[model samples]
Target: MTDFEYLEPEDTRAWVLHPELLNTPAPARRNAGNALEEAVALAAALPGLDVIGSEVVRVRDPRPGKLFGTGKSEELARSFKENEIELVLIDGPLTPVQQRNLEKDWKVKILDRTALILEIFSDRARTKEGVLQVEMAALSYQRTRLVRAWTHLERQRGGLGFVGGPGETQIEADRRAIDEAIVRIRRQLDKVVRTRELHRASRKKVPFPIVALVGYTNAGKSTLFNRVTGAKVMAKDMLFATLDPTMRSIELPDGPKIILSDTVGFISALPTELVAAFRATLEEVLSADLILHVRDISHPESADQAQDVRDILESLGVNEATPQIEVWNKIDQVDPEHRAQVISSAERAETVHAISAVTGEGIDALLATVTGMLSDPVHEDQFTLGFDQGRKRAWLFDEGLVVREDQTEAGFDLTVRWTDRQRRSFERL
Candidate 1:
């Protein structure tokens, strides 16, 4: 008997299809070759698929019927048959009708960009909240494409595998099932979100400014995160390497400690499903005092990648007034001659820094910049704390704000040098 949970993944042969609209810029404004490369990388991120080939199909006008012209469709179908390709990954959106028609015409299981992203998320999510978010997103996406994808479940046989419920058609059952799953996942997700809010409130009591790292997929956010905080946070050279949000406290040289949050990487054409479902995770970005946009300076499409990150940030409601620093990373990958030019450009742009997270080159300057950005002009003041207010006094000293203390008969006299935020927290006591 086949176990449901441990079902083995089929090693299917796959080919990636990218429709490069020659007349229009892609969502990330990437050129055809770069777009195709990214699409292939996305496909490779998922397991159980041997991607044999990928191509850029240039189209002036997209078809609402088959996505590609009849002649091109027939040609690709012949290629698929020859390669025995079991799956075709369309690196673009497809209407339900077009998806169904293409699958029939191509005689292969087809996954649009959204579906492929959902699969990767489902596989990579580690936390409960991450899992629930991915599930809700997947369910929402599947709800739309159920017509073409769930045909296998259209069976009258009374069996366990993808069968309809009593007196219900397959589509009805699937819709109902999807609706129920979404509701169930949302219920669980709500609790997680609430707990996160409570945790955020708790973090407020700690009085550290939150700095969040955001970048395009495989742009080295995790690597920079690890280098800065000395935390082993899975710094892999892969797309969406870190799905879950991780936070750590890092102290600057001669400056106060701040919380640094490493978030999921932004991607070109991030699916609406993910954007909606991952809002809980993106909340960290919203609450950040500073956003560090790390970029792979060596990548050919780095400019387009930066634009895509900004676009996604806008969609997440990160306002224009928010403080963001551009970090031109991976300088180690650049040639010595070109590296000097990059450094010169970064020097010209005060907000941009050229650094290598791997080699720690230019990290001190970056940290000093971070310290400057987060520093609140601190002032020293004297305060009296009674014996009963030992907790408050301890909190002050624990924060490294207290410079000196004098013991008294009834209480203690403390001299504290701190920021406005620390002053507010003290006042709250």
Candidate 2:
């Protein structure tokens, strides 16, 4: 949680490398080029870093002390020096020893995928809970990397200290300090979580179904959310743009009112520390009455991205019985040839819809589908209740289930349209 700021005109020159392990199982490996591109994009998301170059380094055998072999490491060092690279971002997990050794050999700061992501979350987090979660995740990540100066831990700006500031005196951070910080953060987080739970309980009593939007990073969940709810959420084309859960109530056209939630986007190989830290933030997804699995249908690895979201959702323990609709978003970005095919495929699926959240294409049908799914069956019925049952009449009126009420000589005659669940509740009353 360092608060150090980068001086002007001294942006950190960075290089991104994705180590493509030859020994990795074919099914377990991602497209190295795509992975490198994603890493570059991730780097771009952070400020004060100029990503000058990136590549997929094919590694037959990874060195223990240094992730890359001696010759390869030396060659990369020379290239980094030639390019005036001040930071090296490895698009994979790196042990503390490996990271320290790489920084020593290359004469640059080294940040693995997990650290980079933690930094981004630290930067993007706006809410108190989000900031605390990122801090806890960073502490957990840094606890293992105590081999280097934990300057990032001392900054007030909440950065992980991977970018600049080279000549500061190295302060050896102890395990006890980080452990104490973790404990303190947990206490604060528990309070925040309790407050959030109180708010959630209040929301539950509002008689609106909660519909949550979930997707991979930059998959346009926020855009879709803003389009539907008309709320000015920060819908940026960046990784983890929406870090905290944002909810708004909106009445669908000719449909029931629902609480719509936009949640943090999922990514491939999400850091374990982050998953644990942000579980509370993801509780909104778990309690959702319905989930919209948004996808960037125009991306080349859209299917892979969707699977990653699903894997994260499953890990978060979302109920399998909960309904889900596949939202194939960003159709406007897809090519004409594939756009037709994508729309056709979605048309055949009962739970899939293809639309451009920006262009308003196919949104009406999607809303109609959501309405049909959330709308419960209703039937008209008449009932007579005496004045002694004033509480029951009041309850019926409060539920908006009463259509007409007529005063009778004995008491009242009521005509109501309600679902089976409402009728059962009335009978219980």
Q: Per-residue lDDT of 1-429 in model 1, one digit per residue for the tens?
A: 865667677688999988987667545346778888888999888988899999999877888888788889999999999999989999999987787788778778888999899889999999999999998998898778655345543332122245554333766777887898799989999999999999987987677888899999898999999998999999887888899999999888878799999999989889999999998998988878788999999999899889989988998888765678999999999988999999999999989999999999988998888889778788999979999998898788768888999999979999999876567556645
lDDT of 2 by residue, 1-429 (tens): 779977679789999999999999988899998999899999999998999999999999988889789999999999999999999999999987787677778878888999999989989999999999999999998777665544433443233444444323333324666788899999999999999889976874676877889999999999999999999999988888889889999999998899999999989999999989999999888777778999999998999999998988998887566789999999999999888999999999999999999998988998998888778799999989999999999878878888999998989999999875456446645
Error of 2 at 286 (Å): 0.7
Each prediction's Cα lDDT score?
A: 0.85, 0.87
Candidate 2 ranges beyond 4 A from true positions: 1-7, 147-173, 378-429
lDDT of 1 at 76: 98
| TM per prediction | 0.82, 0.83
Task: List, in order, the clash count of every candidate structure.
Answer: 0, 5
In model 1, the number of clashes is: 0
Least well predicted 10-residue stretch by lDDT in candidate 1: 152-161
Those runs of model 1 whose alpha carbons end farther than 4 Å from true positions after fitting are 1-10, 23-29, 148-162, 165-170, 378-429
Q: Return the lDDT, model 2, position 176.
A: 61
